[model samples]
Target: MEFELWYLLLVPVLFGAGWFSRSFDIKEKKSVADETQTLYKGLDLLLDNKKDQALNSLVNLAKIDPDTVELHFALGTLYRKRGDYDRAVKIHNHLYNRADLSKKERARALFSLGQDYLKAGLWDRAEDSFRKTADLESDYKVRAIKELVNIYESEKEWLKAIDEAHILEKVTGETYPSRISHLYCELTLQCMFFKKFDEAAHYLQQAIHADPNNKRALIMQGTMLQKQGKLDEAVEVWKQVGKISPEYETLVVASVADTLLKAGKDADAVRYLESVAEKGINSDSVDAAVDWICKIEGPENALEFLRRYLSQKKSLIGFKRLTDLRLAQDPDNKELKELSDFLKNQIDKTVRYKCNKCGFVTKSFQWQCPGCRNWDSFAPVRSEDPSRI
Candidate 1:
């Protein structure tokens, strides 16, 4: 009987505790409503084109609930976009160090921090944050790898750039021959600057292995061999370029001709020129080859060759060469020579190389596009387009 009375008395106390818990639930719901209303107000301000005020309001709201992951990320992204990298880093770093974050959230936070650091020019810190993303098994792995490639490139760390490029190619299944080829070429340049001819040669070989069609590698290889007094070897490598990439022969024709002359193969050089012309050839190459022919054979022969070649395929450069040669042969004709000179200048402007990727125009060739920073973006101008001007 005493036990029953105690049990009956405890029921009202349990009921009172249940009532208090219900009241707390209601208060929690009200708190959620208030946060939602504040978020709506922030959005309203943002929609009014008051971005600074919106950010301030949202940031203040975020301070009230620091565990709101999306809010922090959005704010951090906005800060970074506004060039406030310190605030971006602060927000992202705070999120990155949160022990309550899941694996994916942690990766995302680190990725953001990495971007902030990179934009802030903190290469080492950016690399550290990106490296942390590797262990997270998120898509940030690929993103981090790509950024690391850029970072290494900016820092002139070619070996690390190559390593990261290979990993990226493997992971993303996308070819990076342009980037890899340039990296190897960069290493070759560094080696050659230090008088490390053998190392440069090795890197050139690696570059060719990475991209056999790379024009820079082919030119550098031939140049290196020529510097080492390997005239026949240089001839062979440059001849390979002529055979594979005839359009690029213009860039290396003078070197090949010199090599052939050094190796006592003048006849072979002329024949190579003839062979390159038999295939499709650029006008500059034709101009150069005809000039070479003038020195080797005779001016009459060069004139004959140009006339016959120009008859088959007409071009401004061909006309210019023909006119110049005719003008040189007859200096007494002042009016004819001046007209030819004026035409040559105009044609020279039109014949300038242009970057296919970025439309960056230049008189000389470039292995990389300066405007877009893309490798092999420039191509030889075959014809004039007045519209581009």
Candidate 2:
């Protein structure tokens, strides 16, 4: 009877232990499920325009799951956008320094840190960051190298820029011919500034070889040749600029014409400028035509050309130029003086140049746009102003 009683009491004790174990298991699973749901809700908040609350929730998630690399990346990007470079740097730096990071993740972190330093204008730090990223043999390495090129260009480290460009081309299979040519041009200019004409000429040749159509190189080469008293060779080289990029030809025509004139090629100068003026009434082209006409054809013929040109084109600048020419031809003509005054006021308020990329207008020309920071964004506007393209 005592044995039976003990068995009955043990049954209840075992049943109670089983129930406790099941309850603990359920509670533990519910806790994990709740944490997962909270993380999902945080992502929802980020998508729903509640960034502050979303960030707070994400911070909580980070605290709970500190090993989540994706969450860290998102947080770091957000901090970077918020202009908290220090925090972004800290997160990315932490990820980069982690021994547990995969090669891919480490590369990503390095790239991000490099961009962070770039935005902060810490060029030295940025260069170091990008250099480390460039060493990693990953998909991001090519991009890292490009960023490094941009950094070196900004810092005026042209040699480093050229090296990075070469690396980028080798790795990415993309041609940076124009950019490479520009780099060589910059190097040439640097050499020229120090009166190293031989080195400058070598760099200019390299620039031309990099991009045969690089007009800047042709212009510089022509100037160099002229300085060396090889006037005929210089004139021939400068003339090619017009054939290659006719749109930009207007720039070189006048300078080339002047050189031709000084070299006793007066007929060639007149013929070239006239043909250029007939095709485009742009400021550069028209100015060249006017300069030639005033010198050879007399002020009267120049004024006549301006009038005939304006009759077809109707440019405000052309009108202004004509008005000036008319006033100069007949200083006592009251009507000409009055017209010039009115046109000058109109021209003064006009936005002469605009960026093709960002549509930012400027009164003066800018090679690199102040608004978008794009190189060669501005083109000398002619009569039919580019409203948009």
Candidate 3:
């Protein structure tokens, strides 16, 4: 019995001795071989979609050799990509809580945890995780600030959003002037809604300072001035909008006209509106001009001006206005009635707005494109009568 067992052991021992020369150690080679085999088996299980088995193997390996930070990270990231967020969270959380982890490894784990929380829509948890990561001062600082900014915006915490946006601008060296202006504008609107006029005014000034060409701020400022019974000042402020962003004249037109009328300068208002119309902006400008003309010059002169303008330039809003005007007068005029009906149908057939970013056309104007989810991407453009484009 002893001789038989010795022969069995001798067979394996001789094979091992032959592979390990006199100068090399046999134990070190066997350890490496065992590690390689374990890794291959774990990878094969994972490839075969046996995630639970692969995880068990990795956990056992981790218990035996706690230094496999790379393997742990790979497994954690794979779990995240596979939508096993809870398991991913557990793995990353374990790594992050390890006192022996290197600073870089800890930061990576914390970032991964934050991303997992974000994916889970636990904004508060994600924010807390990211705040700790901020202390690590990793290269992910800018990315963390950007994520925090998004979180704050989503939560409607405008103050926090403003702070984060400033930090991101400093870190990334990329200007966010328009976005900063929008943040201030959001705060301003919030304040105004609560009748905190002083706070609203301060925020509006900050918004204009952040983006001098912010038409929304100009419009709000003009409205505030008009509400305070400073019609002249309001009109002057509204006029500034046209100088700064000629394309947004339509946005401030109604406000400017009302303020001018209140200030007893209807003629001056009419002149400005007509000037913008002559520049061939959106048809809304022509419609605004027509409104002023009807108010200041009587129906006959307004009709004649509109007819002459329509003969020179074509637009849906202009046509709509002309149709309404014609139908309002001489109701028995069959030719004018027929023309109004035709123009109304044509106007109804055209899309009124388009996304500048993706060229998505829609009938309603949206500040954000529903398709691409970009802010201020929608612009009013002339919709060709199918035959025209």
Candidate 4:
């Protein structure tokens, strides 16, 4: 019984040696009591709203009792929460450099230091600190990795961003297809700017592999082919965008038609535009398509096509288009032409593309919402009056 009791008592003593006072003596016991009293006083000061005094007391306690790792962390956290990143970094750096800290405590201190650096806009130092904080068993491992990923993204290190994106997906079991795909698209942009068509195509393919439904990747691929003077191939590649995201047709239609025209496929372009209209089109896109038709097939043919379409489905937009076309054909009629121009301007002001994610309105289509950074968040069909020019 004596041995068992001594063993039980010995465990806490050993734990305390690691956790608090390292020596089991009268001097160390008194030191522990003094430290405890100081901590209590600091808490009292904090409760009384004497923030500076409380922090000073806590700092003194940390200096006297280097074993009080948790106290240092709390102080650093308080500093960081109060936006005093310099002070937080100093406290965490002190704790981080201590030789006696447990691995988890060290990780915590390092993470705190990284956060200080991050908040201070010290990206390079923050990356280094976060890297040190990464431990498989530590609670901050995933968070550190994610911070590193965000750093890579902010720095535009697309390849490193892609690597972390994979790690994050595996660790969280949530695929970041769009994010991964976009990173590849960014790479493709760089390669294209350098006139490395093959390299750009490879990145576009990687993007497609990452997310088959990534319309931007497809769009980039088409752009790459067009850059290579493969107009037919470019048009074919761009047509895939409509299949992947039908709502994005408005964005891709002009490119596809232009590509078809360059490839001597004017009839194909007209048929493609007609097929697009068959599905549905906003007033602006339809008007733009009619402009294309007037240029390619002739204004008379464009007018007849618009008349037939408006007969089946009438909208204010189509009506406005009809009046404009009629007025253009009879430009000598000054009063009628003036009325058409007035109505067209009114329609232009009222019809707008709006971001469904953030309600940001623009006159032009945005593949990614500028306000919210969300892709395909703008409704395809809703052309409400724009909030901007």
Candidate 5:
């Protein structure tokens, strides 16, 4: 009878424990459901382009569940995209320092932190983070190396950029010859600035080896040769550039003429200019040829040459040149001077080097587009549309 009484007393205690356990489970499930609802709300807000609200919701969720790695990544990326680099760095740095993060997650976090630093213009910190990230065996390794190349390029560390580019080429099993060639060309220019002719020539050779068709390298080679008193060799090298691309012939015409003039070959210079003009290449070349003709041949011959050239090409710039020549010959002609002024204004407003990728326009050529950060993106010919400018 005593044993039965003890068992009856224990049954109430057991039922009380069971009731508390069931209550705790219900609360835990409710908490999970609320977290899920918050996540969905955040996603909806993001999809609706309410990034501020979405960020708030995600911040709250992160506070509730700090272990959600993917959530932190999303929040960090959103912060970076929104130009909140400090917050983005904080979140990503926290994830990177976490002992519980897997190797891949740590790499991702470090890479993200690098991006934050880069966007914030903290080059040294970004370089450190990306270098460390590149050492890790993860998907971000190649990207980290690429960022390193960009950083070096931006900092004018041409040798370092070339090294990083080579590493990238090896990693991706593809050739970035053109990019590498440009980097070497940059190094060559640096060397040339210090009058290090020997080193400059070596770098030029490397540049050509990297990309034989690099026009900049060829142009630089010609300049270096000219500086070394090899006028004939320089002229020959400049001619090769025209063979590569006839449209690019204008770039070398002035150089060729100057070099020939230095060698007392005035007739040769005039002939070269005339040949370039007869091709009906572009406005700059035609204008150059007309100016040379006026100086060497005479105004009458220049007029005849320009009229025939304009008839063939019908260039606004050529027309402007013709107007200027006419205005010079008849100084008191009010209509001609007015027409010249109008054409000058129109050409100034319309002619620009436009980036093919981003439509960025500039008065001068740029190997890399400032707007889009793309190499070789500028059109070879000047754009004559005011709308593009």
Candidate 6:
């Protein structure tokens, strides 16, 4: 009778245990289903271009699964994309400092933290992070080196930038001749700033050797020659730019004209400038040629030259010059003054230097695009239509 009573008690105990196990399985499956549903909802929101909503949805999901490493990375990236660098740094820093993370995951977190620092203008921290990331054995090594190169360039550490650039070239199997050449030119300019002519010459040679087709280096060479009182040599060097790149010929026209004029070669200056204007009838070349013509000849002759040039090319700048001369000759003409004013407004609206890489427009020319950080991406010509750009 005691054995039968014990057996009955054991049966209730076993039944209770089975009931608890079944309940736990159902709850676990529900939790997993909720997580999956939230993930898919977030992805759908992202696909719908609702980034803010998607971010919110993922943030809630992350709250439930605090140990989700990839989810944290996604959150960090979203924060960075939204320009919330503080949160981005927080998320990635937490990930990077986690003791349980794999080496590759830690490397990725550090690289992302470096990017956040970079975008926040925290240069020292960014450099340190990237340096550490580069030391890690991971796929981010090349990217880390590239960031280091950018930082070095920004800080004017030309030697360091050159070294990193060489590493990038070797690793990527892609030559960075233009970028290296520009760095050398920067070194040359720095040397010249302190009147270190010999050092400047050496660096300039390095620049040319890095990229023989570097127009800025050639231009600087001419300027250096002119500074050394070698007018003929300067003129010769500047003229070579026209041969190498005719589109860039206008860049040297003013320098050539000034050098020739300094040497009492007024007629040669006029002839050379006129030829440049004839070759390229853009605003810069035309305005340059007209100014010199007005000084050497008379306003009437300049006006006459504009008339003929406008007949062939039909440039708005050339027409504006024509109206200006006409108004000067007869200042009382209201019609002419109004026409000039209208043209000036129109030119101001349209005239700008545009970057081909990023379509960044600026009033002045830049060697490197601020929008894309690309070198030599801006065409030398002034764009007359922003729409086309």
TM-score of each: 0.77, 0.85, 0.73, 0.67, 0.91, 0.90
What is the clash tally of candidate 5?
0
Off by over 4 Å in 3: 1-13, 19-84, 98-102, 298-300, 303-313, 330-352, 355-376, 380-389
Best by TM-score: 5
Q: Point out the worst 10-residue segment of candidate 6 by lDDT.
A: 380-389
Error of 6 at 257 (Å): 1.4
Give per-residue CA lDDT, model 4, range 25-79, as digits (tens): 6677888888898999999998998888888888889888866678878898878
Give the residue spans of candidate 5 off by over 4 A. Answer: 1-22
User: Each candidate: what lDDT?
Assistant: 0.84, 0.82, 0.79, 0.80, 0.90, 0.89
Per-model tally of clashing residue pairs: 0, 0, 0, 1, 0, 0
Give the clashing residue pairs of candidate 2, or none.
none
| Per-residue C-alpha lDDT of model 5 across residues 114-141, encoded as one tens digit per residue | 9999999999999999999999889999
Q: Is candidate 1 or candidate 6 better by TM-score?
A: 6
- Residue 256, candidate 2: Cα error in Å is 1.7
**Better structure of 2 and 5 per TM-score:** 5
lDDT for each residue of candidate 2 in 1-389, tens digit (9 for 90 to 100) = 34666678888899999999999999989877877887898889978978777777878888877999999999888778778899989999999999999999999999999989998889899889889889989878988898888888888898899999999998988898888888899999999999998899899999999999887788889899989899889888988987886766766777787888888888888787777777763765786688777887688877777777777777767877887877887999999999998877766666367789998888776555778756666775532343421
lDDT of 6 by residue, 267-383 (tens): 998898778767754777777777777877779878877777887887677888889998999999999999999988888888888999998999888888988888899877887
Residue 126 of model 1, lDDT score: 95
lDDT for predicted candidate 2 compared with the true structure: 0.82
Which parts of model 4 have CA positions greater than 4 angstroms off? 1-83, 95-105, 298-389
lDDT score at residue 35, model 1, on the 0-100 scale: 86
Report the poorest 10 consecutive residues by lDDT, candidate 1. 380-389
**Whole-model lDDT, model 1:** 0.84
Per-residue CA lDDT of model 1 for 245-276, tens digit only, reads 77888888888887897789999988876665
